[model samples]
Target: MSFLGFQLRWNSVLLGALVTAAVLNDVPPSYEALVVLAPVIWADRTTLTWVRIRRR
Candidate 1:
C-alpha cells in the first residue's frame, strides 16, 4: 500500500505487525530496533510538519 507517494514495503508491514504484537503481549521492543527506527520516525514527523506548513 502507498501513503502519500511512499510505497509500504513488506518488511515495513511485517515489522509493524511484530511491533504491535509485542505491545499487545506487554513486551518492550529492543534498543537496537528502536535505534534503527529512530530516524524513520523522525523523518515521518518532519514530513508531517512540512506538509502541514505547505497546506496552510
Candidate 2:
C-alpha cells in the first residue's frame, strides 16, 4: 500500500482501539490517550502532503 493508505489505516486502528478501551473501562478516554493520537494525526497529515507532492 501507499504511505497515505498505510497511515490512514493505522490511524483508524489506533482511534478504534482508544475508543474500545474507553468503553471497556466505562470511562471517557483520558488526556494520555489523546496525546498518543496527536502524533498519529500529525504523521497522517505529513504523509498526505508528501504523497500529494510526490504525485505532482
Identify the candidate with maximal lDDT. Answer: 2
Backbone clash total for model 2 is 0
> In candidate 1, what are the lDDT values of residues 1-56, reduced to their tens digit?
22354445555655687689788999888788788776665554222211222332
Candidate 2, residues 3-53, lDDT tens digits: the string is 443334677677778889899999998898789798886665323333444
Q: Please report, in order, the local distance difference test score of every candidate based on alpha carbons.
A: 0.61, 0.69
Q: Once superposed on the true structure, which residue ranges of model 2 sit more than 4 Å away at CA?
A: 1-8, 42-56
What TM-score, to 2 decimals, does candidate 2 have? 0.49
- Give lDDT for model 2: 0.69
lDDT of 2 at 31: 91
